[model samples]
Target: MLIRSIRLAGFRNYTEAEIHPSDGVTVFTGNNAQGKTNILEAVYLCCTGRSHRTTHDKELIKNDHDFARVTVEADRADGMHDVEILLSRISRRRIKVAGNTVSKSGEMLGHITGVLFSPEDLRMVKDGPAERRRFVDMELSQLRPAYYYALQRYNRALKQRGALLRELINAPAASDTLDMWDAELAQSGQAIMTMRRDFIAKLSEQAGKTHEFVANGAEKMEVEYVPSVRAEESGEELRTRLEKELHRARQTDIRRQITSVGPHRDDVKILLNGLDARSFGSQGQVRTCALSMKLSELEIMKKESGEAPVLMLDDVMSELDPGRRRLLIRMLSGVQTLVTCTDIEDLAGADAGKIIRVHQATLQEA
Candidate 1:
């Protein structure tokens, strides 16, 4: 997939702007807070129907603006396509693909796939498990719409189960009502766990090879999915395990007013040379692990979709040392990449593609 252009209206600091990017490597250079990241954010929103930075749509719209509009034009293996997102302050956001309005936002999942890396991603190793889980979720959602559906259902059931648990605390007589939610949660949770296990397994295999190359075979990376329940089982067996676990944790759930055993509490463990990357790996090791995982994502998406996904690097060059930066650039050789940075000189060998200057919310081809 290649993003040919992106048009923004009333998004962040941009009043109105259109950017044409190169198919190989497009660099956006500007100072801090000059709306460089905003461009990448718009592209991400158009692709995923959500922003990585904020969950609230109101935050994306400009001050005093009623809505924020972002339109992206891209070329995929099939053909060219257009994706548009309109975020309104008073109502829900609207999404359209190829000139047709989509009622369900999930329908837009794989229309324009992309993998984004930002400075914050450098801390993913040391960050909480939620960060790692999000990395998996975003990648899977783009590759498989079925996974997205199961995830949504699982979350809804999880929420209802938690609410039932809290209610049971106040009225023990309502305990019977928990059975319905438990069964629903178990079924959906099983599907989610199954997919997560497969995804993590594939990711680990690819990341190991990438990390070896990135780290010059000095460090080996490993990834594993740690489910809250039934770590070794799946399908009906996993569902049965989840049902039993939910029953076992019912009392604790009621007392704690939370669902205790499910995929929500799951984690992905990253290991570097037999050491926990999160707890023992050095800063350089963590960043390299993160990079390897991201590069692995690109390969996974290509395998699943039969084409590479667009790559977005949001001011990530400044966070990496010279050696790592060179490795990352080498990985972007054939993939279409959109990068944001403060200075072009900071990026070695970045002059091969188009250079667009972003200043005062405006873009000019350099």
Candidate 2:
């Protein structure tokens, strides 16, 4: 995958800007808050239907502007593609792919797949299970649209179930209505868990290999999918297990007023040398594990999609040690990568195809 150019208007600090990126590596350098990361954020928004930084769409619109627009032109293994996102306060955001407006957000999933690593991603190992779960969900959504729709269904059912549980807290007679939502959760959640199981199996293998490469074979990294409920049987069997578990935990869920057991409560376990990375690994180890997972994500996207996904690194070099930085650079050959950093010297000697200096929201070639 290659992103040829990105066009922006009223997005963040950019009033109007167009940038042409080379196929190899493009570097955007600037001081703090010069909109270096915002450029990458625009590209990420085109790749996925959401922002990496904020959840609110209105925040993406520049002050004094009612809308923010970002358009991306890329060349993938299949064909050339164009993705455009229009964020508006007047109505819901709109997406267009290849000049055709996409009705559902999931329809734009594979048009231009990308993998991004920012400083905040370091929390994947140090933070709670939500981080790891998000990692799985984002990657899978890009690779499989069916998985995305399944996730949507599962979340909807989960929301309804939670509301019902809350109402049951006030009146217990409605407990009879809970079985319908339980079945919905079981069916959709089973699909999600099965796919997650297979995807993590691949991720674990790739991450283990990458961790060994980065650690020089001195440490072993292990990644496992830890679903809230164990599933090791036919599809019907798994769904049945989920329904039974939800029903069995109904009293507990009513007391807490939340859906307590399912894929929504699942996690990815990261281990180093047979010890939990979140609890036992050093700070350096935690960062290394995160890096390994990201690299693995890039590789998996390439293999699964039949094209190398565009890689975005947002000021991550400063956080990595020199050796890890070198490893990352060595792995960028033949892959389209966009990197942002405060100083260009930190990434010295890497063959950057285009170097742009971002100062005062104005981009100038270095």
Candidate 3:
């Protein structure tokens, strides 16, 4: 539940770096471009297979290096664990736990659950539905390994079905093949939808309470999963519903050369007092809602994993006011937190205590 240390080699701006993180708040203080965020990125990559900064794995390696390695040590119930990720330019990335490779990436999750709060997260409310969907997917993936497995199956089936549909458009004789793919896609998609809806229901319950507290009981925010099809409705019912819609839009899908109906095109809606937050909420409201949602994620992880997860705060306090910053400090006081800030001195009391300075991609105990 706590990151004991992290070792990075040829990752971003850090050539060779090792950090011994404190169980309590550990601040990374440095100016811009001094590798403050890079350290946090390394930690994030170790937990999740991908990065928030970029999708390409090779971009994380050093300019001239062929690969990058990130190893994170954590303290768990049984004992300590070493989570390792090896990234290369030409080959598939490899993941190992305690020196043994794991063929499936979903197997690596939940070993070290972490919540990353970066400046970009503030846009969660204002951005398109894709960002919100990603938020739900990542949070659920960490909390429930089953969700990850189901999601993978659903996505794979979706891709194959789309390809079949594209081919059927050119040759009408392949209609029977399309029927088989439709059934498979529908079954997997239904399972995924069931998991997503249940997860979002739990998330909404926690997020509502967290948002009320963070907003000082002034505003109410709610999250809802608007699936394309309801689960209580039988698969036959779903197929009928989808068939009616797909028949109406067959020509459109052929023109676009993609599958038009399924879970892939669904979305989650966030409502603030009966109005959509993305289009109507003020800037302050949006940011606070996002923060509440993130904190709720920590709560969800704790309940699911039976321990607190590591916290990564990436240059977010700089924009928060003193009141909100104090609230964040209070919530994260006892948890392991890696925070990024330019000047810790500006933060009155909480910031001055337990600060570790970052200079030129290296960390030293303060």
- RMSD of every candidate to native, in Å, equals 1.2, 1.2, 2.3
| lDDT digits (tens) for residues 240-320 of candidate 3 | 665555555566766788877777777887878778888888887888778888888888888877888888888877677
Task: Give me the runs in candidate 3 sitting further than 4 Å from their true place.
Answer: 232-252, 351-354
Task: Look at candidate 1 and tell me the lDDT of residue 366.
Answer: 88
Better of 2 and 3 by lDDT: 2
Deviating ranges (above 4 Å) for candidate 2: none
Q: Is candidate 1 or candidate 3 better by lDDT?
A: 1
What lDDT, from 0 to 1, does candidate 2 have? Answer: 0.89
Candidate 1 lDDT score at position 98? 91
Q: The CA-based lDDT of model 3 is what?
A: 0.79
Best-to-worst order by lDDT is 2, 1, 3
Pairs with backbone N, CA or C atoms under 3 Å apart (clashes), candidate 3: none
- Cα displacement (Å) at residue 205, model 2: 0.5
Worst 10 residues of 2 by lDDT: 231-240
lDDT of 2 by residue, 188-280 (tens): 989999999999999999999999987667699989999999966638889999999999999999998888899999999998988899999
Number of colliding residue pairs in each model = 0, 0, 0
Query: What are the lDDT scores of the predictions, listed in order?
Result: 0.87, 0.89, 0.79
Expressed as tens digits, the lDDT of each residue in 179-220 for candidate 1 is 888898889888888989999999999999999888878888
